[model samples]
Target chain A: MAKTIITLGREYCTGGRYIAKDVARALGIKLYDKELITMAAKNSGLSEEAVAASEKRHTHSLLYSLYTMGNDLPLGDQVFILQSRIIKQLADEGPCVIVGRCGDYVLRDRKDVLRIFVYAPKGWRLAYGKENNMLQAKDEKGIKDEIDKTDRNRASYYNYYTQNRWGDAHNYDLAINATLGHDACVKMILAAAEAKEKAMEG
Target chain B: MAKTIITLGREYCTGGRYIAKDVARALGIKLYDKELITMAAKNSGLSEEAVAASEKRHTHSLLYSLYTMGNDLPLGDQVFILQSRIIKQLADEGPCVIVGRCGDYVLRDRKDVLRIFVYAPKGWRLAYGKENNMLQAKDEKGIKDEIDKTDRNRASYYNYYTQNRWGDAHNYDLAINATLGHDACVKMILAAAEAKEKAMEG
Candidate 1:
C-alpha cells in the first residue's frame, strides 16, 4: 500500500490527542503533535515555548515581532512555514498521523492524505477536562467559558493559517465526535482509512 | 423558554430516523420524518407515493414532469416547496424534531434551530442494515454499492434543495456518527441543544 497521511484537527478537551495516539499505535505510524513544534523550533532556531505560545489566541504578529525583533522573522509566519515544511517532509517519509498545526492544509494537495476533525459536545468536554485534570471549572459557566475561549483560539489560529474552515465537514474526509468515546472514534477512523485506501486502489 | 427546532439529516441505514425519534421523545417534542411527505402530498394535491417516489435516485424533474405533464408542476419542486413551508410552520408552532426533507435549509434563518447530520462508518451501517432487515446485501461489496448509490441520491437531493452541504459541520450545529449507537447519539444531541440554548441566552 502507498503511504497515506492522516491529519487530525481537534477541539480542546476532546481526548483528541489521546485518540490520535491510539490510531498511530494501531496503524504502526509516527504521531506528530507537540513534536511538530519541537521540530519546527529546532529548524527555525527558536525556542519551542515561543512557537507553542504563538499558537495561542490573540497573539498577533506585531507582539511577536516586537519580542523577536532582532530575529527578523515574525513568530507566527516562522512557526507556520517551518511546521508546514516538517509536515510535508514527514508525509514524504512514510505513513504518519499528524495532529493539528494545520496539517490538513500543509498536505492538502496529496491525494493519499486523510483530513479529520475531532470535536465533542460542551458537557462532555467539561466532564472529560475535570476527570483528566486538564482543566479546572468551578461550575458549568466556568466550563463553558474555558471551552469557548480555547475553541475560539483554535478556530482563529486555524482560520488565519488555512484556506479552509476549521471544523467544516466539507474540509475534512471525516469528522468524528470523540464524545462517542476514544475507542469508537479510533475504530471509525481506521475503517475510514481502510475505505480510503481501497478507493485509491480501485 | 424560546422554541428550538432540531433538524436532522442522516445517511441511509444509519438509524438516524431512530435516533431522531429518541431525541424527540426525550425532549417531549413532535417528530417529523416520512410524515412530511404525507403533509406535502396533501397540501400539493399529489399522492404520497408520488412524493416519496420523487425522492428516489435518478427521478429527475424531466421524468417527473412527463408523468404529470398536464399538471405542469414538477414533482420534486412541488414536494420541496410544500415541505419547506410545512417545516417552517411546524417550527413556528413550537419546539420539534424534524428529520430529513431539507428541514435544515427550510429553517436555516431561525436562531432556535439546531441542525444536525447523522452518519456512521460503512461497517456499522452494513451491520445495522442486516440486523434491522432494512437491507439484504449478499456481501460487503453489495452492501457498499447499495450505500454509495443511496448516499449519492440523498446528497444530490440535499444539494439541489438546500444552500448548504448536506453533511458539512459548518452547515449543521452538530454532526454525529451513530456508530456509537442510538442512545449515545440522542444524548450528545440533547447536550448540544442545551448548550446552544444556553449560548443563545448569554
Candidate 2:
C-alpha cells in the first residue's frame, strides 16, 4: 500500500492530536507528535528541550553578526537546517501524521504529502483546555493568554519557514475546523485522503 | 445618514459596474470605476497612460533599493501613494461603490467598509465580454487568456500590496460567484450590507 502523509495544525487544546491519531488508526499508519521532538533532538545532536524550544519558533537574524563581532552563531539558520533534515528523514522513513513544526511548509515541494490545518473557535479551545488537565494554564484568562502566544508562535514559525501565512487556506490543501468536533475532523481527513489519492491518480 | 464604503471587485465584464450603479441608485449614493483611475492619476500627478498601465499590476519591489532607481522612477511607489490617497478620499466622500484596484485591501481595516469579490466562469465571462465589448480580446481563446491574466494580476497585486492573498474567503468579508448572475451578486451584497448594519446597530 502507498503511504500518505498528513500534517495537522490546530488551535491550543482543540484535540488535533487525538483527531490525528484516530485518522492514523483508520488508515493503519503510525502517528507522530512529540515523537518528532526526540527524533529531531537525536538527528541534530541537540537536547530535546532545546529542539522543542526551537521547534515552532522562527530564527530571524541575518544581521546577527552586527551584534557579535567574532561569533558566527545563527539560532534561526541552525534550527531551519536541522528541522528540514529531520522532517525529510521522517518522510523518507514512512508516512505519518505530523503536528506543528511547520511541516506543511517543510514538505511543500514534495508530491506525496497532504497538508492539513485544524482549527476551532476560542470558546471551544478554552472549554477543551479546561476539561483536560494537559493545560498548564490555570483559568480562562491564563488559557486565553497561552493560546494567543501559541498561535503567534505557530504563525511566525509557519510564515518564517514557508514565507506564507499560516491558517491561510491558500497555503494548505485542506483546512478542517476541529470545532465541528474531533471525530468529524478525523472523518473529514480520512475522506480527504482518499479524494487526494484519486486526484493524484487521475 | 452616516456614510459607508462598499468596494466591489469583479471578474471581467460581469456587469459589475451596472450592479454597482443599481446599489448607488438604491442608496442614493455615488459610484466610481473609471473615475477612480482619473482620481488616482490626479491625486498622484501621473499621466493617464502610466496609471492605466500600472493600475492592477504588482511590481512588488517597494523596499528593494536596486529596483527603485531609474528616470521618471518609482512607478510602483507612485501608484502606491495614489491608491492610498484615493482610498482615503472615497471613504471620506462616503456611501459609494468603488470598483477594483484592490479596494478590498485598502478598506480592510475600516469598520464602515464592506468588501466583496465577484467572479464568473470563463464561458460566462467570455459571452458577457463579447456582447458588452468590455474586453478588447477577440475570440473565446483571447477572452479566456485575458481573463486569466487579469485575475492573476489582481491576485498578485492585491497580495503584494496588502500582504494578504486574494480569492481567499478569509480575507474578504464576502465572495460572490457572479455566475449566479450579476443581479444576484448585487442582491447578495445588498443583503450582506443590511446584515452588517444590523450587527453594528445591535
Give the candidate number with the greatest lDDT: 1
TM-score of chain A of each: 0.85, 0.85
- lDDT comparing candidate 1 with the true structure: 0.75
| Fnat per predicted structure, each in turn | 0.14, 0.03
Model 1 bad stretches (over 4 Å):
A58-73, A136-140, B1-40, B43-99, B103-202
Per-residue C-alpha lDDT of model 2 across residues B1-202, encoded as one tens digit per residue: 4256788776566777788788777778878885665575665677766566556466564444235564455565566657766776778777787887778777767777767666555676788888888887777787789988977876776766767667564454555544445544555566556655554565
Candidate 1, B66-167: lDDT as tens digits: 466756766666666777777788788899998988888788788788788888767778888888978757787888898888889888787766645667
| Model 2 CAPRI quality | incorrect
- Per-model TM-score on C-alpha atoms: 0.56, 0.53
Residue-pair clashes, model 2:
0
Looking at candidate 2, what is the lDDT of residue B118? Answer: 63
Best by DockQ: 1
Question: How many residue pairs clash in model 1?
Answer: 0
